[model samples]
Target: MHDVVIAGGGPVGLFLAGELALSGCSVLILERDRDLTSPLKALPFGMRGLNAGSAETFHRRGLLEAMLEASGADRKEVGADPDASEAPAPRDVSHFAGMGLDAGGIDASALPFRLPGPAMAGFMTSLEAVSTVLTRWAASLGVEIVRGAPVTAVTQDAGGVTATAGGQEHRGRWLVGCDGGRSAVRELVGFDFVGTDPLFTGYVAKVTFADPRQLPLGFNLTPTGMYLRTSFEGHLGMNDFDGGTFDRSQPLTREHLQAVLRRISGTDVTLTDVELASSFTDRAMQATRYRKGRVLLAGDAAHIHSPLGGQGLNLGIGDAVNLGWKLAATVHGTAPEGLLDTYTDERHPIGAAVLDWSRAQVATMKPGPNAPALRKLVLDLLSTPGGVTHVYRQTSGLFHRYDLGGEQPLIGLSAPDFRFQEGARLGELLRQGRGVLLDFGRDRALQTAAEGWAGRIHYAAGPVRNDLGFTALLIRPDGIVAWADDHADTEAFQRAATRWLGHPRTWAPQVGSGRVE
Candidate 1:
């Protein structure tokens, strides 16, 4: 039996597999699709934006450089000067309902606990690039992936979980559904999926347009609906406000697509041929809970919303990162009490926020008499520096606080990429997937106390180029700031460490123990 059985071998599943393998847990991935290559996963249609949060996660995992190369993005564009004493200003902002925010308006000084690092900005990439990079990483870690195996049944008991895929039974100590929005594991596990329904039927297609000039490029909001045409030739998108009544399973024939485009654009734009097409709805929904006994869900299987803000992929990546380490710890029996449950506690609110964000975009773009007025009001507010900064903080995926109940403001947030004078960085330390305790004060007590958790929590002490006014900090394996203190309080540090990494103690490996010491 594998330590974990994952449904869906896409980015989330691959990433979680790698994380588990990094912790010496065996993982098996059952993918629904036999082939990874699909037109929708290539350029143009497959294009996705990796927010700074996602970038930082990859950096901590030592995969950022490869991801950038796979996406054909220049390192200079995505990274900042690593040697700089201070963090760089934010340089990227996401659009709100086609209304762009000026990166210049983002107040860098306002964001707390930020430090200069390689991944400072979000960049464009495709699903294929992300998958390629993650697949490579997961395979290098010895994760076994079985494609063309769609999960059909899942049964869990006191011991573990057994999943039926492709007419075969695979047993694992735990199971996670990383499958896409239409997830079989979630359904079979009896997770309650609840949320608002969709408002419109959206379409994306690659077509041969006879009269491309008839429809204007970029986002065009008409009295009836909205249509978008990007620089990619023949790439078309439309959002038809038909109460989301269109049956998505129906064939997207050229005639139907042309009619919808013409109606939304209010122009007789001709689609000579539709080479490819897919339909989606703003049907926002989320599983009530992330885990059900031995079975769990992450990525789109846990929650789903419209792709309006380009947050779906990034959100899933966050889920994988947040859950990966905790699950691994649980499987290893080294996790603190309730550690596995915190996955839902810390992430559910974030997922809820993303869903509401998507719904807000759809509301602003919905065809109605009040839409123009609402859009105008929103645009006016977004024009201000404060408004722009708020949007950046919300959308950049960097500023979320997980409510870890620490007094310091930085607690419950991602740790700053603190760099030691020796040129080591927090990001590099996290590549091993273990808790990190940085003793900036180099106090003997703190160092001695951290030794109890030796192998489980890596401890380092030294002067950093910038300590950000902290003498010490405890960072979780996922890079979250579990605790930070301006003074080297050994008692506080121990408490924080014990809360997250379990009580510090040395373990001697016994024969056939199947445990890491």
Candidate 2:
């Protein structure tokens, strides 16, 4: 039986697959779509722009920089140099600062969270770029990516999980459904998807050569939840650029898109060079349950939100990445059953929050009196140092903290970025392919305890700063802290590991001779 089989090959599924494969777990991924070569549409191409947090997550997962560099290198090879092309290279690969347009690189280290940005239209370049790197990375990690294997049915029992796809039957110790928003595996398993699909249909169009002069100052117009282009550059700065750009407050049609350009910018419009365009509704909702026995759901199958936050795709990927390692450990007989349960605990709350934010964004953009008031308030909030910092924090993905009951040091807290004297920094260390286990390397009690779990863990020496809250942290393969000391406790190490993480001996270590052993 395969250790784990993921139902989707989208970025999140691919990311999770990579994590599991790298951790030495045998992973099989079944993607319904036949075209494996086709770049996965990780986001709504016409109207999706990533925040800083998305960029940082890619970085932590060792994908952001690699993907950008790779895309640049590919462009150089293919003569599609982002710097030289009529169409810009995808966003992540393109240096936003160099291009004169960016999310106003404000430092947000001091902030608690990042508020999401107003919806804008940007190229689907970042997702594609990240996918390029992820494809290669996942392959390198030994994940068997099976395309056209539409998962038709999924069922789980006490022993393991069984799935049927493309008329083929497969068995695995666990099955993870990383399918898209409308998940087939979730349906097969009868998981109730709870949430409402909103009425606003996001009409997306990637029209090219739409004479630049014909547009208003803003490259993007948010007048009526409608717009053209990402954002305007050249002098208007960010918000002031596209004024007459299709009042986003109104229902948009293909004609509306064309007319807005011609009327505002005094330019003729035609769709000769149009590359891609489509429409999808903005629905803010999530699955009622993330898991039901050995069959589990991750990615879009678990939560589907409006495209406002650009959170849909990244959220899904993060979900899969978080779940993969835990499932893998369980499969390998190293993690406790409780470890698998934390996936829903940690992720559902984030989904609920996204839903709330998307609703606010939608309400703020509607065509009504509230629009102007909300617009001013939002702009005011976005422009403030505090507001900007909030946006930055959310975008950076650094603010995400797991619930460790205020007891586990690094377990619940995000390990802040730090410069290291050794070969790698904190991110680089965690990026080395698996979750890290930072051993004081000097504490005898800790060392002795670690020695017993030698086969599945890695050791590291940390004179790790004391206030970071974790001394002996057991970081999961997905870079989440599974266990850590609350206040540098030398003896609580084993209990911490067994309780939070899937440490081998989660059950009581049979009171050996009624002594501490």
In model 2, the runs with Cα more than 4 Å from the true position are 39-65, 73-125, 208-212, 217-219, 231-275, 407-410, 431-434, 439-441, 462-472, 482-488, 503-517
Flag clash pairs in model 1.
none
Tens digits of per-residue lDDT, candidate 2, 1-517, equal 8888889887778888777775677889898988755422433352234443444445456665465464343323222232221222222321211112234434334542122211111223445655657777777766788889999877789988999998998898888888887889888988888776464545455555445555453334344333445452311111112322322556544565455444433457554443444445556668777888888888788877666656676577667667766776776677766788788888888777777766666556555546667667676666655666555445434456778564544456455443233434445555544555675434666766766555455556656432243455666556666666534455566665566445554222111110000
Which portions of model 1 miss their true places by more than 4 Å? 507-517
At residue 488, what lDDT does model 1 achieve? 92
**Superposition error at 189 for model 2 (Å):** 1.5
Q: For model 2, what is the error of residue 31's alpha carbon versus the real structure, in angstroms, after optimal superposition?
A: 1.4
lDDT of each: 0.89, 0.58
lDDT winner: 1
Candidate 1 total steric clashes: 0
RMSD of 2: 9.6
Q: Judge candidate 2 at residue 176 and give its lDDT.
A: 86
